[model samples]
Target chain A: METTHRSVVDAQDTFTMAREQALIEAAQAGDKQAYRQLYDRYVGRVHALSYRLTADQGLAEDATQEVFIQLWRKLDNYNAKSKFSTWLHSVTANITVSYMRKQRGWVHRMFNIEGSAAEHHTAEGSAGDVDLEAYIVRLPERARMVFVLHAIEGYRHEEIANMLNMAVGSSKAQFHRAKHLLKEWMGYTDE
Target chain B: MSKFEQQLNQQLHDLAKEKAPQRDLWRGIELGIEHQHDTGTVPQNRHRRLAAVAASVALVVSLSWYGIQQTSVPATDHPTGQALVKALSNQHEQQKQALLVQYTDAPAMTENWEAQLAELDEAASAIKAALKEDPNNGALLRMLQQVHQQQITLIERVHAPQWQQI
Candidate 1:
């Protein structure tokens, strides 16, 4: 629970952004110390997203490690046009999703033998007691991925469709499915 | 949108964006990156190092046994050239078996290594025969040692071609 956010102090935005770009440049030139500074600044954000998407802490930890390892090699691909955070978040999301998909076969075969309920996670706490994070993990797998990408991470339906390799309609359907299930679980029946 | 829907949207926006994992993850990241870069070399280099030590140990044992046998010979009695050849041949056979067993799994660069070894063995036999006529000749004994050394060197090279000269 490292709390990091963009500066509320708009006056410092220019200087902060410049320093960030300088750090990125140094890291791209193979400065591991600079890369580490980037890692410290960004790891928490990456971990949170990874955990939300995978719903498994160990998998999230692995995905987070892979993200930075991939970043070190692909640093040069950072065109620096958009914010580096935006670019890196996409990278993190892609790697985490890919990691999950690699396990998808095992998940698929398991569900074939057992019902989907066996694979589905349910938060033990009552709706009022449990936090949203617990509830997020309880959604159906594809729906959870869709909702986390679209609602929480702020990727649009089209972007999520592309990310998840589904039709745009399918992405929206899954998001609606996720939102509907979550609202029902949280005791918000009135729409 | 319903008030609840808007509330949910706001909650999603306000959701914690950063969650620190229970453990530090940088060490693993560093190792992963370094390991990828050294994927072919690191473990292979370690295996080579281990094999080099084993080869050296085998050679040392063989030479030590040879030394003990040499000392066991009575200084007053003139040990025949055949006796010295027998000792050298026995040590070479042991060393060759050890070297071949160590390198069985590895590939040898030269296909005709056995033939080359046969030629060296033939040369050693000829040198031993010549030694029969001249048991006291220093040059013949030196030549016999040289032939054995060449065979060992050849075995080492063929098995571990990347090995640096010892």
Candidate 2:
């Protein structure tokens, strides 16, 4: 019975993939409706990642809007070598980083300035906000970028290092620092 | 890591990756997508119009200038030489006016495009003055013709989406 259920799920997955490929091709051909469908499908994921990385609602919205705009122009660059979601998530991360850099401006980026651990995170009184996500965003700026890209987004430390322009050791250190801070913020006291 | 700490790590991995924003972001994205589609050129049509205009101008400049060179005619001394300069200058004026009219309904790509045009006009005027004195010089005539092309090219180039963004 389990095997039969797996076959059905596999068939459904194939259908979804075929449909998504068609949508992508249509979008590449400049079909706005197809592009709109792609936007609808990916906007939530893009906004989620943007919010986590920037830790500011307003910046997240601006970033989300910019991501889709960029995606529309860049659709022709997307190939089938990777899953569409994977490619898009990578694009979203890169664009959000660029958007954040623009918001921070070149001066801050040159000086490697970042906010404190407690800056820009909302109070936890709001309903339906995930505790872990809230805590992750509260991590210091570089640490949050390193953690979100490495841990949650499944980027290797080396790749994170390249993306963030940090040394490999710095990326690993930031990831560990982010993990330690998250543990403390979550009240995990075990050795 | 302890068992509870391991659970915390697992929880981090288990967090849902999708969270719809409190606002409807698609509208903004859709508007953005539309705006991009407008500014961006379609691949097949990329620069086709500008290329056609430039090629036509080149053909006209080369052929007309060749006719003058064949006679080895001094421009101020020969009617054809003087006429050739007038013809080329008229063509340049027409191309510039055409480009300006084409983009007249649209916003100017830069505030100084007109000022830039005036500067080019000054350059063309100086070239014409030199041509009046050294009318038989092929290089001077060539320079005059090329400057006319430059004015047309500048109008089209700046009006295209290729403007330097702030």
Candidate 3:
């Protein structure tokens, strides 16, 4: 029975892959309707990823828009060597990072103003609902980015270092800092 | 992992599954794509205008060439319109070559942009060969000018600063 179920699952996966490949081809051929169908399919996940990375609802929305626009422009670059969803995730991650960098001006970066700003913003948004996501948003900028990319997105420290242009050790350290802060906020002890 | 860590991980997984943007984001994405599409056409429209201008110049030059031939005028009576067309074509060629040299090491956005440029060059060469056979062929002259315009546009587009960003 287990073997039969596995085969059936494999067949469904193949069918879904074939359907997505056709959609990608049609979208690449300037079919806006086909592209819209793709948007409907991926928008929720993409928006969630963007929100986690940027930790701001407004910025996440902007990043989501930028991601789709970049995707449309670079559709022909997709070679299908990997799953379409994987490629889309990589694209979204890169665009979100770049968008965050652009939004964080030199003054904000130099002064490290985003932590307080993000905390205040999150507090305002999460009036009665204090959640893990709200705490994640209150993390310092670099720590938040490292946590999201590494912990949430499943990227290794080496990959995060390259993506963020930081040393691998720094990526590890930031992730540790993120965890320590989260634990402290949640009142978790070593015991 | 500790129990706390496991709890945190599960919470994150649940958050990913349950969270979504408050608004329908497709509308913003559609607007952004439309804006990008509009900006993207600026280069093509510029190419069309260039081709139109080149055709006008070709038409005037061809008319002068025909007039001189019909009147049976002396060679020195008017400046050679053929020489003028050749000079204009040479001028465009020189500009295109300069652009090529300027962007020799610059990366192109599209993988097949060079192939597209080569195809335009081949079309221009074919038209030039036909023009040589019938020196005063007005249609061939116009086509050659249009092809030259296309070549300039292609080279400029592939080497555009924005392409490097892409």
Candidate 4:
């Protein structure tokens, strides 16, 4: 009975993959409706990724828009060597990082408004619940990025280093720093 | 992983999976796609139009000077030199305009491409002003052609498909 159920699940997975493939091909051919379908399916995951990296609602929205625009422009170059979702995630990561770098210009720093909300919330510890999202966003910029990419996104430290243009040791150290802070925030005691 | 680390990882994984933005982002995404399709090439077209007008004016001025040079001097003195220069300049202008159109919406690899292009334009202008004063100065004319070629080459190299790959 369990094997039979597993086979049914496998069949459903195959069907979903086939549907996505068709949608990708249609979207690549300039079908707006097809592209919209793709966007509807992926926007949540993409936005979530952007939010975690950026730690700001507005920046996430901007990055999400920029990512989709870039995806549409570069869709023709998406060969099917890897899964479409994997390629899409890679593109999202690159664009969101680039967006963050652009937003960190001297003007933003001069105003002392770079990621200020997260810094303020983290400092005040005013979050009512031990919310992981709240804690994740409160992490220092480099540590937050390293933690999200390494812990949440499942990227290797080396890969995170390359993505963020830092040394691998720095990525590992930042991950540890992020882990330490989250533990401290959540009141986790070492046994 | 330790028990504490495992718990942390589990919580993070759940958060990553379950969290969604507060708003429906699809509306924004749809609008963005529509905007890209509707007016993606408008800026490039505008730039090309401006370039064409400028090139036309430059061509008229240069050709008038070429005509004057042709009649005032002996044919064998420069022997199609003015015509050759005019043809090369016209060709360079067209190629530059085509490149401007091709890279109309290409994301610049570097932040200072505009500044660099402006500097090249300034250099070209200075050379052109000198050429206006000494149209028969072969060295000044050669410098102007080189500057123009540099501008096209710089624009093309920065916006090439290979840069996008990098």
Candidate 5:
């Protein structure tokens, strides 16, 4: 059954791979149509990642636009060594983290926002609103990024480290710190 | 690290698995791209209209100049050069207008590529600077490496051989 499922998935994967290749080729050749098709394919995932990072829908939308624009121009560089999604995720992660860093500086400069450890997470809301995302967003910026990519995105620490430009140890530490912070904030006395 | 972490991971995954955003941006993106392509080419009617206007003006000026020359008018006083210069100026203005249309219609094609590249450069620079501030910034270093790899790949693409159409 797994083989049958695998075969089906593989067939779908093959189709997707072919489509990605065609789009990349066209985009590299400066075919705006192909570039737009590719953007349509991944814009949501990128936007979701951005939203998770920034915790602001508006910022996420802006970052999503910015990231895709970057991806379109940089499509020439994508060699088929790894999956295009992985390369895209790397770009998304880098862009979002960069945006977060800039936001941190901006917020600090514009307003005297200081780093604090205590956060009161509300658990009583719609499933969409009161969820792990809210908790993840409350993590310190770097740790939150690591947590989202690793725990959420299922990337290994090494991959997370590479994507975030952090040490594996730091990535691991951040994930733990994020989890601990979440657990504390949610008042998970059962744990 | 614990069952709590495991649960947290599951919860995070569930949150992430929410439906992706609507693909309306795709339509906007496609329109933007088409607009760029349209602007890149000169509209035939506009070009032809300008050409006809210039020709008509030149015809009138030539008729007047011929009449003046027949009257033994000084050649230097003739506005032939000025009229030709004005026609040339009009042609330049038409070209400029076409360029402006191309630019305004599809701004992404006009300026976003460089802006994206500059953004990537700034990202790379930030990672490097962060690394400098904390030499053991493994996360920052790893990100820098990815950025470096990406930057190199982009440069290669920009310099890559253009594909030939059959």
Candidate 6:
């Protein structure tokens, strides 16, 4: 069983490497089909990252497409510099933050210029009542971004600061504020 | 251990895995590249220019197989027109320099006499050449007339000093 599992893992690894190489070559050659194949392979994770940060389905989809378009235009810049996945993750974060800033069509920008803003983010539960997702979608943009990156993506506050161009302390403070807002939104009473 | 944090994290997991836009939207990207190639814009790849050219030609052929043909200007004609325009512009500069050298003592009346004439000539030649292939093209005819009028102005500039000032 162990030997079989090892062979399976090896085969899968080799397949993945070969597939990635082929897609990269095709994308370099200006083959949109190869780019689409690559988009299919990574877009799920990219969407998840986008949706988590933005909490808007439409916005997430738009960001995903925009990200891939950049990937296509900037393929030569990739340089195998870091792992493709990490590079993609960085792109996702950058795109999501920009989308958040541009939400509401240039009016009532979500982030407040005060000390901090608090907001909620939730997952799945009963649909009829004010469930988790509805609450999360209401969070102020910056705090929500920090919370999503910290809790969902498991990034440290310093890393979040670098991605967001904010101070590490500010990122940590925003994470707490986001959690506090979620507490308020969820109506989780303390005894 | 706040309930909000737990719920938010759960919601995030549910949210992250949702469906994204279909992959087919990228179909337009390659089409855009082909359009650019056929329009005779220089390909950007410097290291593998031959490969880029071959790939662009292959793309045009393959895409044509699917009934999406590029406009039927011969490949040679497209590049030659582009090259001719470039060469004529260069020649216009040289003509301006030659006129300056030849007519140095003749004129102070018109500052850009040579440039004006060369531009008119270039424009007229382009329009005349275009109208030969596309006689019924109203746009080409209008352009040709515009070039002819422009050339008349250049003739006036060239003779301005002899007739008016000196």
DockQ: which candidate is best? 1
Tens digits of per-residue lDDT for model 4, A1-191: 99999999999999999999999999999897898898888888898889889887756876887788779889998988998888988899999998888655543555565343443443433223457887888888888999998887889999999999999999999999888777767666544
Q: List model 6 lDDT by residue over A5-47, tens digit each.
A: 9999999998997789778878888777887788778878887
How large a fraction of the reference contact set does each model reproduce?
0.74, 0.66, 0.48, 0.42, 0.24, 0.36
Off by over 4 Å in 6: A99-105, A109-135, A184-187, B1-18, B22-24, B27-166
DockQ (Cα-based) for each candidate:
0.27, 0.24, 0.18, 0.16, 0.11, 0.15
lDDT of 3 by residue, B1-166 (tens): 8766876777677775425666555654564565465434324535455567665765565465545655766544224535555766786777688888998997776787777777767766665664454443333444556556767777767767883435
Which candidate, 2 or 3, has the higher lDDT? 2
- Show where candidate 1 strays beyond 4 Å: A1-8, A110-130, B40-107, B110-166
Candidate 2's TM-score reads: 0.61
- Candidate 5 vs candidate 6: the TM-score winner is 5
Angstrom error of the Cα, residue B3, model 5: value is 3.5
How many collisions between residues are there in candidate 2? 0
**DockQ for model 1?**
0.27
Please give the C-alpha DockQ score of model 4: 0.16
Q: State which candidate, 4 or 5, has the greater lDDT.
A: 4
Each model's TM-score? 0.61, 0.61, 0.59, 0.60, 0.53, 0.52
Q: Give chain A TM for each model in order.
A: 0.84, 0.88, 0.86, 0.88, 0.77, 0.76
In candidate 3 chain A, where is summed lDDT lowest over 10 consecutive residues? A121-130
Report the C-alpha lDDT of model 5 over B1-166, residue by residue, as the tens digit.
Answer: 7666566556655675432653234433343333334333322222344356545654554455445545855545325433433443354345445544544433232324455446556765654454444432223333443443343333333333344111
Task: Compare candidates 1 and 5 on DockQ and give the better one.
Answer: 1
Judging by DockQ, tell me the better candidate of 3 and 5. 3
* Model 1 error, position B18 (Å): 0.4
